[model samples]
Target chain A: MSKDNKEELKNDTIKENQEEIKESETLTEEVLEDIVEDEVSELEEAQNTAKEFENKYLRVSAEMQNMQRRSNEERLTLVKYRSQDLAKKIIPSLDNLERALAVEGITEEVKKGLEMVQESLVSALKDEGIEEVPVTTFDHNFHMAVQTIPADDEHPADSIVQVFQKGYKLHERLLRPAMVVVAQA
Target chain B: MSKDNKEELKNDTIKENQEEIKESETLTEEVLEDIVEDEVSELEEAQNTAKEFENKYLRVSAEMQNMQRRSNEERLTLVKYRSQDLAKKIIPSLDNLERALAVEGITEEVKKGLEMVQESLVSALKDEGIEEVPVTTFDHNFHMAVQTIPADDEHPADSIVQVFQKGYKLHERLLRPAMVVVAQA
Candidate 1:
């Protein structure tokens, strides 16, 4: 072959070798970039899953705490008002005892005995956190105005004229509202 | 240059090109292998994270369910036993009324009124889930054996001879044990 032809063939081979090197380098770089991108996306997905679990755990924990608090409060309220139903039932018995005391035909001795019994019933009620609702003034919250009476000098307007039937309370809750007579102007 | 020298130069260049191409090819293969290894590890990590989150969520859900069931049961118990305290308190009042009824020399009117009061009291107690502990035989659970009597033909051994004081129960709970006289063999 001619020297020129030989030199041309060598240059072409060198150029081809350079292009192959460049292509291989680019391919390697692309593979590295793909690895980095895959790792980043995988990490992000794992992090998102962890974050979602954390949020769910937090929400469930908060709900559990709230339910616990509500249950505790309900239990406390129940304990505090444990005697409410029986205390309310006993009120009518107390009213009967008071009525028996009002009866005029009983002997003094019998009346005295009845008075002692009434006192004991009152004490039993008090021991169980039951008490008469105080109604010096007419308050709609605690006293039920059964009848309205004209205001007098002693009983001003909106004042309690008289309590017809006594009201009772257990703890802070009203067991029975006072059946009362309110004074009106 | 001589023909042999030129030939030698050309062969050296071709050999160098071949070595460079082989090196680049190996580097490219190594990079691809690294990318595949990185992706496999990343995928494993992601699976692990998801498994961990699933376990956490299941545990939290189970705990929350248990707590909810316990709280509901506690609330039900509280409601069921709400009248126990006042029922227990009213026992002594009932005893006093019984004593008053036993007294002699009272007028028939007074006796009738007292009977009515006792009935009302019993009704009230019943309304609040309080009932007398009935004892036909000696049961240690609800009856307190205060006195022992010799067993006769009429009264079998381990039988309740007489009730000195009535026992009462509020729902399933014993409010007061019956003070009784039991027959012995």
Candidate 2:
């Protein structure tokens, strides 16, 4: 072949190789970018999953702590009101003892014995956080108005006129309301 | 320049470009591999964290359920034993009433009233899960030996001869041990 023809051939070959190299570079860059993008997204998804689980764990832990606190408070309340039902059941018997004491014609020994028994029972009840409800201005929470009398100059409205049945309380809770006659306007 | 010289120069340029492309490919492969490995490890770490958090959440949920169950059981037990203290205090008073009834020279009316009070009180106690402890054979768990009598044909050893004071129980728990005379060999 002529030298000019040969030179032309060499130029064509060089240009073709350069184009091939450019194409290869572009392909490698695209492949690398695609792989990196896919990996980054996968890693992000894993991180998101981990965060969600962590949040759930934290929420449950807080709920458990709250439940424990609530249960303890409920336990204390239950202990405080433990004697309510039994005290209610026994209040009527106390009334009976008072009635026995009020009876007439009992001998000195019997009267003395009954008084002793009554005093001891009242003391026992008191020790158990049971006590006679104070008779003050008639409050419906501690006194039940079975009868009402006219309010006069001496007796104000809502005043306790007579306590027919004494009321008792256990701590702050009422076992039975005192059955009483109240003055009304 | 001569055609030969130009061809040699072109060949050199093509060789250099090829070498440069090879070098670029090696570098690209190394970088891509490193990035992929780093991302994969990060993903694995995140997945492990998520698994750990999930396990923690499950454990906490179970603990809460167990705690709730335990608290409910304790509440029921407290309710069952609510009357224990009050009943203990009242037992001595009940003994006082019995002593009052046993005295001689009481009028019929006084006796009747005393008996009525005692009966009502006993009934109230029974309703509150209180009951007189039965006097059978002597048992230290339910009886206190205040006096000991000689064992004979009529009274066997470990038998109860007389009861000085009645014992009582509230539910399954003893309120007070009975004061009693026992027969011993």
Candidate 3:
């Protein structure tokens, strides 16, 4: 071949080789970019999943704690009111004892015996968180007004005039409301 | 230059280009493999974290349910025995009423009133889950033997002769054991 032709052929071959190298490099770069994008998306999805789980965990944990607290409160209330039913049952017996004491012409010894028994019963009731409802003032929540009487100097308006049946309480809860006569203006 | 020298130079350049392409391909493959490994490990880690959170949630849920069940049981027990203390307090009053009845009463009206009161009180107690303990046979669990009487044709050995103070129960629980006299051979 002539010198010029050989030189031209060599230049063409070198250019082709450079183009192929550039193309391969670009292809490798594109492939790497695609792999990187896939990894980033996967990481983001995993992060979102973790965030979702964390939120659910926190909500469920709070709910569990709230339930525990509520259950404890209920248990405490149950213990406090444990004697309510029994205290109600004993009211009638107490009324009967009081009636027996009011009977006329009883011997001193019998009256003394009844008084002792009544005192012991009162103590027993007090020990078990039972107490008489206060009757100095009229409270609708704790007293039931069965009769209304005209207000007087001694019994002012909205005051408790007389308790027909004594009310009892177990702890903070009322076992029975006092049946009372209230004074009206 | 000779044709042979030019040919040799061109062949050497082509060989160098091929080696460079092979080297780039091997590097690309290694990098891709590393990226894939990283993604797989990340996915595994995410799955492990999710599993851990799920396990914790299940355990906490179970604990909360168990607490709820236990609280309910406690509440039921509290309700069942609610009248025990009150019934115990009323026993003394009942004893007093019985004593007054035994006394030689001069008036029939007083006796009748006392009887009516006693019956009403018993009914009230029954309504509150209080009942008298059975005393036909000697039972150590429900009866307290204060004295032992000689067995006869009427009373067999290990049988209850007389109840001193009547025993009472509130629901399934023993409120008071019966103070009794047992028959002995």
**Candidate 2: CAPRI quality band:** medium
Worst 10 residues of 3 chain B by lDDT: B105-114
Ranking the candidates on lDDT from highest down gives 2, 1, 3
Worst 10 residues of 3 chain A by lDDT: A109-118
- Per-residue lDDT for B1-185 in model 2, tens only? 98667778998988988887788888888988898899889889998998898899889989989998998898888888878887787777788888899999887777888888788778878888899998999989899999999999999999999998899998878888899999999
Off-target runs (Cα >4 Å) in candidate 2 are A1-16
Can you rank all candidates by DockQ, best first? 2, 1, 3
Model 2 chain B TM at 0.87
True contacts kept of each: 0.49, 0.69, 0.45
- Against the hidden true structure, what lDDT does model 1 obtain? 0.83
Residue runs of model 1 more than 4 Å from their true location after superposition: A1-16, A29-42, B1-13, B29-49
Q: What TM-score would chain A of each candidate receive against the reference chain A?
A: 0.84, 0.87, 0.84
Clashes of 1: 0
Candidate 3: tens digits of C-alpha lDDT, residues B1-185:
89788877886887787778788889889988898888878877886777677777777778778877887888787777767766787776677767767776435655665676678778988888788999999999899999999999999999998888888887778888999999999
**What residue pairs clash in candidate 2, if any at all?**
none
List lDDT for all candidates, in order.
0.83, 0.86, 0.80
Task: Give me the displacement of residue A146 in model 1, in angstroms.
Answer: 3.0
The DockQ leader among the candidates is 2
How much is the lDDT of residue A40 in candidate 3?
Answer: 78
- Per-residue lDDT of model 3, residues A1-185, tens digit only: 99778877876877788788889999989988988888878777776777677677777789988987887887777777777666676667677767877898766656665576667667878988988999988998899999999999988999998888889887777888999999999
Q: Is the docking of candidate 1 incorrect, acceptable, medium or high quality?
A: medium
